[model samples]
Target chain A: MRAVFWKELADYFGSWRFIIIFAVICLAALSATYTAAQTIRGDIAQTPTEYVFLRLFTTSGETLPSFIFFLSFFGPLIGIIFGFDVINSERSRGTLSRVLSQPLFRDSVINGKFLAGLTAIAIMLASIILVVSGLGLRMIGVAPAPGEVARIGVFFLISLLYVGFWLGLGILFSVLFRRTITSVLAAIAIWISLALFISMFAGIAANWVAPVDQHSEAEAILEHERIYDSVMRISPTTLFGEATETVLNPGKRTLRGVVLVREVEGMIPGPLALGQSLMLVWPHLVALIALILICFAVSYVRFMREEIRAT
Target chain B: MAPPVVETIKLTKDYDGTRAVDSLDLRIEEGEIFGFLGPNGAGKTTTILMLLGLTEPTLGVAKVCGHDATREPLKVKRITGYLPENVGFYEDLTARENLRYITRLNRIPERQASGKIDEVLEIVGLSEVADREVGRFSRGMKRRLGMADVLVKDPRLVFLDEPTAGIDPDGASQILDFIVSMSKEKGITVLLSSHLLHQVQKICDRVGIIVKGCMVAEGPVERLGREVVGGGQNALEVQVTESSANLIESIESIPGVKAVECSGDMLSIRGDKDVRAEVSRAIFENGSLPLHIRAQDYTLEEIYLKYFREE
Candidate 1:
């Protein structure tokens, strides 16, 4: 497995495919961070001073979304790009049988690939985070508080899990399909539906489940929001979006329907502490982890049982 | 005698209700190059996969070096190497890097692996191109790399599935020579699967013919030829300058002639023994001139065709 892992890692870093995809991701991420930093600089006086650095990630400018939004939307693309050809290319190259014929267990092939992909994602994410932070520091002359730094760290981890889920899905497709084109097409289709078009789908589904009108009462409105939120959560994109929102913007109290005033009469109005914020998104984190494991497990089983033909 | 290097009893595999490999009983002794001869989809590759433990057998068992292929696959794989049909490498990495990965997977120490990689590359005549990215390599070069890949681990048994399928005659011969030398010098047991009959006959100590998931014949090439076409049988063709009833009759009357066929000025005689001497003398006795006389030997191609035609 170590052999496969190290080889795959070198291939990923050395290939033009990795360089191009990573460049696109970094350019988009930096631009979003630059725009957010500018927006934060202009409004520093009105924003909470302690969480000013956190706002560098959440504030959107006139033309671009926040840094977190860009990541949530593009993280899946990175994962899919890295994983969509993992097995099928080897199959087409006729190397899978050769590698499997060596002195290692069959599971080692899939396990090694998944671990290598995760490591690459970690490296990519870390670099982007470091560069973005550096840019933010230069533009906005405020260092992040310790609590804010911790939240950012947690956010990085969740993003990794989110991308890892997509990587697993890509590998699953690669294992199930014989041709690289077919596997890549399948993965991209799923990515389009879940990452790009899922919100549109969720809106339609949610409206059908809990319809509302202009004159609808507060109860109907709350029901509609509840249905919409749940439906959106079905996509890892939404899970990642909500999770990072809670971690990066400490003031986000809940991802649920609007609470009644009576229930919040004595509750604190300030941002939740890092631990409390984590508690709020715990379920989201679990769901992302579960998604990653499920994809890996299914792909592993299918690959282990697959008949590898030399041709 | 010592245990066979590869043993299979009643091994079988079914894909989607169609049996790809039927119950096959095969035993290959150490230091022998066993040719697995079959046409496309004749269960040759399927058998290799099952023996390598890449796929499970529907019935019976395969044992490699006394280890159960399905239950103790790692052990079986540890002692065996496979050069898959149309073998592939990481096109972006240098040849040495690709081999380095395999050595790591086999868990060879770094110092030893480097030496082994260089040694194998030299054996395959790829030392000069070791630093070249595999994407720039030709088909023949990739095939040679495949050979080096299998040899890097110094496996006790190697499975080569059509190692020279699409290479030029020169390259194919070179690969065949490599296989022969590896067996002779290293005492490595080889199970070579290919549809190319003459090539298999040239290097194999024994050959097995399979048709539609069943083993049709298995033995030394000469023995199989004798079994299929009959021992001591001769097929002789004689060409004459002039044809007449007298000449035909005289040739037919020759001792050992079983059947006589005449087309144009040629007579094809089937005999239980060589009668070229008597036939030539009789032609002269009949006052006819003999132009040419030739005897055809039954080769693996003929044996393979006989099996398929019978089926």
Candidate 2:
């Protein structure tokens, strides 16, 4: 298994696929950093701050999206490309049977691949985090507080899990389909539904479950929106989106329906502590982890049951 | 007495409704080049998969090197190497890199594996292209690499499924010679599968012909020919320009030659020894002026057609 891991890791790094995908990721990170840094600098000019590092990751200027926003949008592709051809391509190349004949357990192939993918994700994500932090320090002229640093670290881990869920899904498709193109297309199709269209689907389901009646009062509408939001969180894409928002943007007090209190109307706004932010998004984190596990489990079983000889 | 390298008892497999391998009872002796002969889709690959423990049989069991293939596949796999038909490598990695991955899976210590990798590559005559990416390799080169891949583990038994399927004749012969030498030098048993008759006849010490998942015949080439066609008899065809009714008596009178008969302008001689030169000399000296003399040896193809045509 260690052999498979090392070889797969080398293949991932040495291929043109990794070079192209890494280039896209770094460009996205740098552009997001530049835009967020511009906004944070303006904010600093208006009011000096200790959590400028966190603000740089969350803030988006008029012309560019934040780092979290870009990652939430394009991160799945990285995972998809990494895993879309992991198994089917082996079958096509006729290496699957030969590899299985080695002195290794059947599960070792999948285990090694998944571990290699996670390792690559960790390294890529860490590099992006460090690079963006550097840009923030140079642009904002302020270091992050210890609590804010902790929040960023959590944000990085959640991003890894979020991307890992897609990696597992891609591998599942690769095992399910005999053709590499079919697996890649399947991954892209699923990505489209979950990343781009799941909220629309959830809205449709929510409307079907509890329609607002149009003539209903604001209270009924609030109840309708509550179901819609929770329903949208069923998609891992949505879960990761909300989780990162809650972690990266400490000012995000809640993801649920908010109720205004007249007694605290004049109270000043302040960023939530790291622990509070974590508590708020704990469910999303768990859901992402569960998604990763379920995808890996199903793919592993399917692969083990499959006959290695190509028909 | 040492156990057979492979023993299968009533082994069967079904994909959906169609049985691929049905009640196959087989024994492959230790250190012999055993040929598993069958036409396309004749369950040769399915049997190989079962023996390697890459796929489970629907019924019965396969034991390889004393390990139950289904119950202890990892143990069987540890001692077996398989070169699948059209075996593939990581097209992007160098030949040495590809072998390195296999060594790692076998858990050969780094110091040992690196040296073993070079040794096997040299054995396969791939040492010159060790640093070249496999994508640029020819079909024949890839097959050689597959040989190197399987041999890197120093397995006690190697299963090569159509190793020369698409290779040129020279490459095919080279591989055939390599297989013969490996078994001769290291006493490594080989179970080679191919539909080609003459190829298997050249190197296989024993052969099993499978048709529609049934073992139709099994033994040495000569034994199978004798059992299926005639006992201790081979035919020679003599085409003469002049009809010679008296030539039959003259041919039979030669020692170890019998069953001489004349059909039209051709004389058929069935004999134990290949006395084509003497028969030609006899016909020439007898004034028949032999136009063409051909040996009618019963090859695996003729034997295969005789049995396969039955079902």
Candidate 3:
């Protein structure tokens, strides 16, 4: 397993695809950061600390501070590219048959690829985080508080897991599609529709789908809206973005003004509490892990049972 | 009385509704260079894939070095090294890196790997190009590197699918020579598959001719040649001074003459037994001056064409 892992890791760095991905992610994050910095200099300079935090969490601009939003939207795209051709390329090149003829088990090949991709993502994320954080500190002219540092660490972890979800999805598509181009195109289509288009149309979809007649009871209307939001959040990217926002800012209570209000008269939970935020997103986390495992399981079984001679 | 290095008992493989390999019964002896000769889609690759555990047989069993290929693929893989048609390596890495990676995956002892890598590189004539990136190498160079990778593990049995395909004649001859020497000097069993009849004929002691997923004929190259070209009997070509129609009739009427064809004054005769002396005596007795009489042996090309054209 270690041998396979090391070779895959070397392959990732040795290939031009990895370099291109790293450059794209870095350039995108830096562009977002620059825009955010310009906006911070222009508006609400004397706002209170809570209001400043809220603005940082809610707004998307061109400064390093706004990179979290760009990353959440763009990171999954990178993850998909990383894995969409992993197995298919090997098969096309005729290397899969040769590799399988060795003493290593098939499961190790899948596991090693996953670990290598994950490691590459971690490296990319860490470098982006380091560069952005350094620029942010320089611009703010103040060292980050320990709480702020902790929030950033949590955000990094969330991004890693978010990328993991997409990596698994791409690998599943790779196994299911015989052609590498088809697998990559399929992944891109899913990304464009779910990541970019779904959220943009969520409100309109909700409005069109929901019954807005005045005769309808408020409870019924609220129930209808809840279903719409749940369905939209089914996309792991959307769920992870919303969760990251809640974790990083800590005070934002609702995402897009669609909140699941649970009436609890006995005790009022603190809105900015980290533990509360984690609990709220626990289901998304579970779903992400489940999706990753399912994709991996499917890829493993298919590759093991697949006729290598077919390619 | 050593066990067969590889054996298949009525092995079969079906793809979708079509049978790719139908009840293939094969036994390859240890240290023998066996040729699997067939045209495209003749199940030669399929059979090799099944033996290497890259594909599952639909029915019956295949064993490599006494290990059941389906149920115990790892054991089979451990003893077999396979080079697929159009074999590919990590082009971005150096040839040495590619061999090193395969060697590691095959779990060659760490201490012995460096020496084995060097030895295999030298064996494949890639020692001078070891440090060059595989992407920059020519196709023939890449193929040699691939062979080195296969041999790095020192496997007992090797499956080579069109190992010399696409190579220059000089490179192909070098590879064939190496294959023959490996089997003879190291006692390695080799199963080489090829659509090119002459390539296999040059190196293999025994050849199995397959057509449309069926083994039509199999035997030592000389024996197969004899069987297909009429049992080792030579064909005699005679250019007589006089009109040869009478000579041809006389030759056909002579004992042991199988067939006779006459073109102008030239007569060609095929016989089941050596009849050169008898033909000369008959020609002399018929009062015809024999201008030229030459005996010719049947080439493998003739035998291959004869058998392949049968169905």
Candidate 4:
């Protein structure tokens, strides 16, 4: 296992694809930071100083840490591209057969590749966070509190796990498709449909499918609203981003016009509590982890059982 | 006694209801270069994959170095090195880097890995090209590098699938010579598959001809040649000064004459027994002089053609 891991790590560094991916992610993050800072400086110059960082962190509640959102969107894309050709490329090159003929176990090959991809994602995310944090401190003229730093760290973990989800998906596609192009296309299609398009459409579809009938009953409308929110948050990226926003800024209100009014005579717990927000996103995390495990399992079984004769 | 390097009993592999390999019973003795010859799509690559445990057989069992390939793939893989047709390396990595990756994957001692990488580069005559990326290598250079990767591990059994395919004639000959020398000098059991009949005839101690997924014939090259060409008898072409038609009739009537044909002043005769003495005497008696008589032995090309014709 260690042997396989070491070799895979060496391959990641030895290949130009890895270096290219790193450069692309870093450049994307830097560009996003620069664009956001310039846009806010010109448009929101009259706003209070405290709201500057808020705008940078949450732009219209749609993007989180503008840089983090950019990284999250591209992080999984890089993971998919990095791993979609992992097994198929080796098989095409005939190296898979050669490597399997060695003392190494088949599981070691898949595990090694997965770990290497995870490591690449880890490094990329770490570098992006470091760059974002440094830029934030320089621009804001103040470092984030320890709690904020800790939350961002958790956010990084969530991003890594999200990328891992796509990496496994790519590996599974690699096992199922013989051509590298086909595997990569399948991965990208899934990413675009599920990660980007599906959630957007699901919300609109849910609204159309279950319209709020205000004349019927107030409780019925509330139930319809909850269903819409749940369906919209089905995408793991959306859920994770929203959870990060809520965790980083505890005083934010929801789009549904629910505000935390501390002056109320008797206050009931709102939905913005950290633990409650985590619980709301917990299912997405579980589902992503499950999807990753299932992909890995399928890939492992297919590689072990599938015939490897060259065409 | 130690087990045979590779053994298969009634091994069979079926793909989509068609038998790709059927009841292949084979034993490759330790330290011998066993050549597998066949026409295109003869299941040679499929059989090699099964031997490496990269593919599962539909029936029966295959054992490599005394370990059952299906049940104990890791054990079987531990002692085998496989080189596939159209061998591919990680093109982005330098030749030395590729070697280092494979060496580590095979669990070579870290201290010895650098030395082994250099040793294999030297063996394949790629020492000068060690630092060059594989993407720049010619087809023959890639094959040599692939062979070097297999050699680095010191495996007990090496499965080389068309090791010379796509290589230049010179490089092909060098690879063939290298395979032979490795088996002879290092006692490595080599199972070589090739569509090139003559190269196999030159290096292989024993040959198996597979046609349409069935073993059509297998034996020593001399024996196969004899069997295909009718019991080692030579075909003779004799030129006579006189067009003695009676001499042809007389030679055709010889006791051991298998065939006799005459065109112009030449007569071609094939016979299991030497008919030279009787033909010369008949020509003399018919008042004709024998100008020349040349005996020709069967070549591997003839044997290969004869067997594949049955397909």
DockQ of each: 0.68, 0.68, 0.61, 0.55
- List chain B TM-scores, each candidate: 0.86, 0.87, 0.88, 0.86
Q: Per-residue lDDT tens digits of candidate 4, residues A17-41?
A: 8888888878777766666666566
Ranking by lDDT: 1, 2, 3, 4
User: Best candidate, lDDT-wise?
Assistant: 1
TM-score of chain A of 2: 0.93
Over B105-185, each residue of candidate 3 has an lDDT whose tens digit, in order, gives: 877877799899899999988889889988899888877877787788888999999989899999999889889888998
**After superposition on all CA atoms, how large is the RMSD of candidate 4?**
4.4
Which residues of candidate 3, in runs, are more than 4 Å off?
Answer: A30-65, A200-209, A213-216, A253-271, B231-296
> Looking at candidate 4, what is the lDDT of residue A56?
51
Question: Distance from true position, residue A35, model 3, in Å?
Answer: 5.5
Off by over 4 Å in 1: A214-217, B231-297
Which stretches of candidate 2 lie above 4 Å from their native place?
A45-50, A213-219, A260-270, B231-259, B263-297
Q: Give residue B300's lDDT in candidate 2 (0 to 100).
A: 83
Poorest 10 consecutive residues of model 1 chain A by lDDT? A93-102
Which residue pairs does candidate 4 place in steric collision? Answer: none
lDDT of 1 by residue, B1-311 (tens): 66789899999888889998899999999999999999999999889888888888999999998889899988988889988887878777799988987888889999999999999999999999999999999999999999999999999999999888999999999999999999999999999999999888999999999988999899999778866875557888889888888888877777889888999998888888888899989889888889999886678988988888898
Candidate 3 lDDT, A47-92, residue by residue in tens? 4454243233335664354677778778778799889988888888
